[model samples]
Target chain A: MNNSASTSNGSTLHEIVRAEISRRITTGMYKPGDAITSIARLAEEFGVSSITVKRALSDLQSTGLLTSIPGKGIYVKDRFRLVCELDVGMSALGNIRSLGFQPKVQRISVTKERIEDVTLSVFNPPDRLLLCVRKVIYADEVPIVYESSFVPTNMSDKIVDEFGKRFIIDALKRYKVAVKEMSFIIDAAPASQEAQRVFSVPNSYPTLRRLYNLKTSAPTMSIVGIIESPFDRLACSVRPGSGRISKMNKKK
Target chain B: MNNSASTSNGSTLHEIVRAEISRRITTGMYKPGDAITSIARLAEEFGVSSITVKRALSDLQSTGLLTSIPGKGIYVKDRFRLVCELDVGMSALGNIRSLGFQPKVQRISVTKERIEDVTLSVFNPPDRLLLCVRKVIYADEVPIVYESSFVPTNMSDKIVDEFGKRFIIDALKRYKVAVKEMSFIIDAAPASQEAQRVFSVPNSYPTLRRLYNLKTSAPTMSIVGIIESPFDRLACSVRPGSGRISKMNKKK
Candidate 1:
């Protein structure tokens, strides 16, 4: 059983204002950690009453996009915008840098497993065993992405051995294993138990889950990456179109 | 306050098994509306015990990926995979068609308003009065997308007058209004009251929201499209890459 907040004509107006403010945040007009104009001033600018602006800002606060500090006024929270396109090959190290935050590998480990790793076998490993590389990438001090990528041992002996020590993307490039194909599945779901424990969020907190399947040209290998990030810690965004964007008709 | 179902030693194995099954559904190994083998069969195939398979299938069922019929058997639900590429600009019509479903415009209307439409003005319409084109696209019988796109009247008189009568993409093409640039924002948020009411889903049900901003040449107009779709009704998927995928380092 659930109840939606009362939505009438006034709510429609409230939504319009809230959506407008949200658009500014998403478009980077309100940069992370920037102060926002007072509600009364915003009211005058939008030509709406102060109540509308207050409601709009209040909604933003609830969504973790804006923060109202005690006596310090309101400011945009750093909802660190993450790359919407999953093809950021070396992004595990680059995403945080572009956002002006120090990147750190909070945790890293590698394990080799057999059929016991039914999950990794989806990569269709030719051999019965595969290598599992897990890493936790952080933005500044906060954990952002919890990733577990898999590669069949036969795909490349170098990748199986060096991925844990070196950047996984660098290992691929160094060994001349070119990724020819990739696919992504993006969804919004409750954070996994492991993510909840790692990120220390409440149970069932919403997360942006991205799974990528990569294919290599040499030795014909299959690699899989599973990335889970909480909504509060990441935002997926596209740059304002710089050039003509061909119609994106991606078949599932 | 919430409690995570106790995740113990067996839980990790359960997740691995569940994840592999999830990968299959997402990759279309099990297409929408396909029957799945019995839990016993899946257990044998994965070389796991029946209890592990049972828990994995139960988790998938709860997630709406697989559904069980009392007397019949488990089958894949119609997750209706939609385009992950929010640039599906015109795919409001094409997406369903590509999925082998008939698409119908459930509702179509146009309106012109001033500053009250702050949400529309994010497009930065040149005129005080902007044209808002709103439509609901349906796949077969279920409403899949609710879209509201705006165009400043001064940019294109034809668009303001004729968009309601013709396919929007066609109107843009016929008028030679080429989109020079575009950007997208994709996120998962609780279903809006409008979406919940329209889609007949629960309050706060998870929904995929995609907002797009389009820029055109010539008169230099700004266009914006806001789309809200329920997760149960639509999914964002990328096809297995056919050609090499360029590094997707999209700057927000």
Candidate 2:
């Protein structure tokens, strides 16, 4: 044995085993739908306790990277999830394009509305009505993001018609609303009915949501609005290099 | 009419109405469970179309701050959400304290394990096992965060035992691991079973997750770890000042 079972602290053993097995799946060493080695076999191969192998397999199960059958065995999860390296300043649209999918923006609605539920700043006139634009972004014709953008009401009409239908930041740039700072409030919630309808997912599908507050040179137009996307459709990764867009295997 | 409804662009009108009504509810002028003014009355008051008022109410309904009764009327949503202004550098524990909660860390387990699914850096030795620490952080005895930290296995055993039972940053400071840079990857997903067990929620609960990658003076000890929190237990807001510990109305 590489190390005595008694010497194993058991804390990190499963994670290592999990990672080794996860690597195999990621690299196609274990194809989707292929049954993985049994717990006893994995324990023997790694020279770890059976409990450690079970723990490792369980970790992978939680990640939706593998699944266990009642009597058969664990198999690579037969699903593809599209994960993007999304960040505050990075262009998600560009990222979609880089992922080999055609990106499109469909304008749902745009209107002048009063600001509600927003982070107040010195620049934003909390009492005044603002412009709100609602839209959906599509990757290869499948909706991925449902977004609402709020801006100053005084924005020019022509600009509103042509504003960043895809990005509020682009609209800010066009309006010459120089963004001095950009901060984020990130969270997740059950998909709203509107979100579900747009994404074609059922109610309560997990969603990734972000509220971006941009401090602009114009106090009145400092903040943008909110973005919501399906959890299965998007991934925000730690390192930019580590986020390679996976080929979405099916409609998520 | 104050202004002819026909003259209204209708785009921003409903949002303005929505914001005004939302403001009233937030300021407690309309208390929770208070049956708000009828749609016709609100429409007459605003001098816009009744459709606009309905739209406004529908917008508020989605926020969980208001509810619509089938036959009665639209009323203020009777719920409290604790929102915080979270940022990359702010001490979340301190934030919890500022919100009037006692923060405590309960160590689950610590072990030496191999690294996988991590951001590789010049400093991190991808081939070696590392120290892993798992723990839960509580706010007023309510489990809020489940975290796992990874560090070089070469760390002293004393350091591992004491290593940031609450924070990896603290351990890094003690070990004189000079951090050169820090980056983040953020995403959300359906709560894993372990998360459900920790948060005591049912399956399919949404969760917010983040991974932090740190570059330190020592190449082998670059990245730190991950943190997972139940979404309903946390509300990340746009401004730090806006984040205040809310009264726990009931167990979430």
Candidate 3:
């Protein structure tokens, strides 16, 4: 009937039907592959319309918890067993390695240049200097991450000359600068045309954007931004217990 | 010409062009808002086909680094400036709140049920007992997350009867079972027909799936799997600070 009022309170006949089936599946009352009660049957049991029951089933299907075959009943889908957390440390690298992922750097450009206010704010250099590097990192040669990073220019005058270097971190090591603290922010937005080519996604696809700060002590050393396609194709994992990086708080 | 190769590492002329532009962006040679080199100019400079240059520009656009306008050529897109992290704690709630999101839960069903092998493996109940709750949480009254959670049956007898009575965490607290640890796994897949209706997403839209493990003293208290629509709509932030839950590890 009028499901409008229930919308505000988060109660609806569709939700009721969906919840019933979900409870059965989670508690083992209805095992996977078990044929669920038909919409007609649920409509009668709940004393609601069949449309409501159908709506409820639809809610469960969207979450990937259920699958329906035309002319057949609904069933539960396979579930992933592992737990993953996104972090940046040796442990994070280890987790990726464990997943059998090979990280490859497709260097796009390396140049030394004057810092701008926006870039300077992220990588707070002591003087008017900065180095910028852009690359697309692939997992198993499948481009997944596009990154743009900025470093203090004065820290390494040789950065521009050393264009096409393999890894920026390795270059930093050559300059005897250790990365200490990092700040990160993540958001979602529509993919750009270039992103589509690298990730092989459609023009309208959405990507996860991650901006992070690389720091030595309290002052920021570098600012890096990465755009990941389709959001879920990339899984980041961090281990607990070893090779820990020193931590520092963000500047106010 | 003839850039195709059997192996995945084969570099096409388009890829090379993409690499060149990416390098310029990362090096600060082409700052944000700057007009990217024209397709004709790049094609001539690289001595490659215009098709190759076009493909490279399209790739960069999909990566969220470039924007193209009709008859106006391509330009660098504005970049966001926030340090993003994978948030696993209450900080996640804070981030969600900062977005002005209001969460509303609708109980789909509440039931007590027997344990089976599949449910046992996912939840890891302590004594063959379990209580199941199925819910759909909305943001701004829009259906976004669908969750099916399983709890120890004996831990909270008559849980199903408690429907529409209290908040989920509050009800669990009544059982003297505090959530000590949580684990999560995220993935992406195409949404189902049912999801299309609840989320108002068109068919074939990609969604994110998150699996959560709630525990007390290393024993599983509950297991929840959430299927979310417009998966990229919500931003995720993780803070790696000193906490009991922080001690847990993530595997990709």
What DockQ was computed for model 1? 0.24
Q: B110, model 3: CA deviation in Å?
A: 4.0
TM-score of each: 0.61, 0.60, 0.50
Best by lDDT: 2
Q: Can you tell me which runs of candidate 2 are displaced by over 4 Å? A: A1-90, A115-128, A218-220, A237-252, B1-91, B114-128, B235-252
What is the C-alpha local distance difference test score of each model?
0.63, 0.65, 0.53
DockQ of each: 0.24, 0.19, 0.09
lDDT of 2 at A99: 71
Candidate 2 lDDT over A1-252, as tens digits, reads 454343323347876687688778878989988999998998998988998898678656645567677688988855534565434222467667767878898888888777664433322545667788888888887677888777677777766765546566655555566666665666887776679678655334678877776666654455567788877667555332212111111111
Interface RMSD for candidate 2 relative to the native interface: 15.3
lDDT of 2 at A147: 85
Q: How well is candidate 3 docked (DockQ)?
A: 0.09
Across A77-141, the per-residue lDDT of candidate 1 in tens digits comes to 77544543444534556666765888777546677765343333334545556677877777787
- Local accuracy of candidate 1 as per-residue lDDT tens digits, B4-66: 332233346667677777777877888878888888787877777888887777667645577
Docking quality of model 1: it rates as acceptable
lDDT per residue as tens, model 2, B93-197: 666776687878888888777766433232254566778888888887878888777777776777677654646655565566666666565677767656767
Q: Candidate 3 chain A, which ten residues in sequence have the lowest lDDT sum?
A: A242-251
- Least accurate stretch of 10 residues (summed lDDT) in model 3 chain B? B82-91
Ranking of candidates on DockQ, top first: 1, 2, 3
